[model samples]
Target: MEKQLIISVGREFGSGGHVIAEDLAGRFNLPLYDYNLLEHIAEEKDVAHEGLKKYDEKPKSKLFSRTVRGHSNSIQEHVAQMQFDYLRQMANEGKSFVVVGRCAEYILKGNPGLVTIFILGDKDCKVKRVMEKYGLSEREAQQMCKKEDWERKYYHNYFCPGQWGDSRNYDLSVNSSRLGLEKTADMLERFIRTKMQL
Candidate 1:
């Protein structure tokens, strides 16, 4: 049987991380679990897709709620759990897939086939990308970038404190600004090929 291969991508906001993840998935012919993970959880008759969509990747929910499994958890906690649970199920089923954000790296820790990658770039580079993509002024883009990055940090650290953006935790760390998005994806494909063969 082939080994399970999971690529967990953690990235800074506006770093073109999602694009790179898509590139990697295409090169490897693996499934990318982003919004579809939410859809997976939403299939449960009792779980509300709108509820998960509303809070997807936002900061920790302040209100505690009961999970369908009957555990008392914050809304954020419950939603995050349902996603992680699905990832585990996929892994256990020996499926290889790539997951972006939602702290998949930490949540899927201990899986031998997991490849953890963190994507970051210079502030100017990221801000420029945001401005171009969102058609916002420089200052507005800067504010949005700052707000989203902090929210992602707070969200990630809420579950795994002090772990976000720590280069030590990731098997590979890339600066898309330095390599450019295409080159970065090409380089990562090479790395994943060699890494997975071991």
Candidate 2:
């Protein structure tokens, strides 16, 4: 590969998006910044780390949010800006990496090496994956899947310019229900290689 490769993956909850990101990162020998983006923002501060975890993927307030220090960003807004700044810095410096979620596809738009992917699964597959992974009852898993997808949609809609799962926003969108996790990752790899001429 002559150029940097940045793969931004967005997945429905329980769609094994994170696992697929991990697999791609390992295969391509790139760093993956997933949930650890919180740690990057918190900067090893235990209290802030826990606090940010609690606010994970939450949207900013439309009404009560205010700007301080010449910007009217809520805490969530601040954290998101910081995360996006890091992603921008990385892309600008020609670093190759795989980043999961936090509207990265929108954040790093227009980079020549950028390859955005959204992974979604059928409702039954997603619910079953959540149940087995989290040791939850079927009803609990179903509720979790619904809540997570809703939160992700709201977060993206609130902060980003485009719909969260819209295929037009990404270079590729794959349904994990069809090929499953491993095969889906492989399929995405093929797309990435051909798309980027890797």
Candidate 3:
């Protein structure tokens, strides 16, 4: 019985995290769980998939005060927990997967076979990618990147109770800015094989 590989990716926005996950999944024949996870959870929980997308990978601000009480978890908190639950269930069932954000590293922290990686890039590289992908001005892309980064940090702190982007929190942290996409993927693929003793 071989241990399944479960890769949890924490990434900066516009850093090509999803692209790397997709490539890894295709290369390794594993399931990639990104936004599609919301759809699956929505169907399971009878909630609108769009609702999950709206809050997916982000923290509840004052705007969501109604959904994230301190003394107790709210509906949004509950849903997020459910998503984590589903992720674990999938892994326990022997499925190899690449999960994007959603505090997945924290969710599966103690699993010995888990490979946690944080993906980040230089601000200029991220801005350029954002601008090209969304046709935004450089300034606009930079702003969006900063905003998303803050949200990811807040969400992780709230749910995972850990610092975001701290290399200590992850098994590996890769700078896609320096390595570029293909090289980063290749390096990570090799690293995973080495770590798993495959």
Candidate 4:
């Protein structure tokens, strides 16, 4: 039997990383996990989805008061564990899948079928994409990109030992802006197939 393949994509905000993943998933007929993963966690834990959204791709609040620190930390730990458990469960099913962000690459490390990818783009391209997608001004888009990138970095650094987006941590790191989203997707799909020796 062919081994299952799991593609974990870590992407800069506004980098079309999700789009690339979606395309790859479609090509491979694999389920794509992104916000849907959070939704599943929220439902399983009976927590408000909105509350979880605040913690996604973000570090624990450094400004929380001591009184709430314990509660906040507990909640964060629970959520992280839940997500990790779900990812592990999915991997064990031996089904192919494409999971975007939420530290999936780190969580699934050491799995022979795993292919970790990090997607980034030129700052100007990222800003443009964000502005168009969010209907924001250029300046607003630029600020949002920086803030989101920092949050992702902080979250990954906090939860995982390796620096996020370091090529050493990923099997492949591609700049979507250089190749465009469609071409990037094609390139990644081919790369994954090659890596898996399909």
Index of the highest-TM-score prediction:
2
Tens digits of lDDT, candidate 3, 1-198: 266888888899989987888888877788889878989877887877876576676576555556325453455566677788999898777777889988888898877778999899988899999999999999999999999898888888888767999899898999998989998999999998899876
TM-score of candidate 1 versus the correct structure, residues matched by position: 0.90
Q: On residues 2-87, what C-alpha lDDT tens digit does candidate 4 reach at each position? A: 77989999999999999999998899888898877878877887877877765556676666523354454545555666778899
Please, what are the lDDT tens digits per residue for candidate 1 over residues 60-95?
Answer: 655545445756567677677778788888888788
Which residue pairs clash in candidate 4? none
Q: List the residue pairs that clash in candidate 2.
A: 66-72, 67-71, 67-72
- Candidate 2 lDDT for residue 67: 69
Give stretches of model 3 more than 4 Å off: 63-75
- lDDT accuracy of residue 90 in candidate 3: 84
Candidate 2 vs 4: which has more lDDT = 2
The lDDT, on a scale of 0 to 1, for candidate 4 is 0.86
TM-score on alpha carbons, each prediction: 0.90, 0.91, 0.90, 0.90
- In terms of lDDT, model 2 sits at 0.89
Question: Which lDDT value does model 1 have at 6?
Answer: 92
Alpha-carbon lDDT, every model: 0.86, 0.89, 0.84, 0.86
Clashes of each: 0, 3, 0, 0
Error of 1 at 14 (Å): 0.7
Quote the positional error of residue 63 for candidate 3 in Å: 4.8
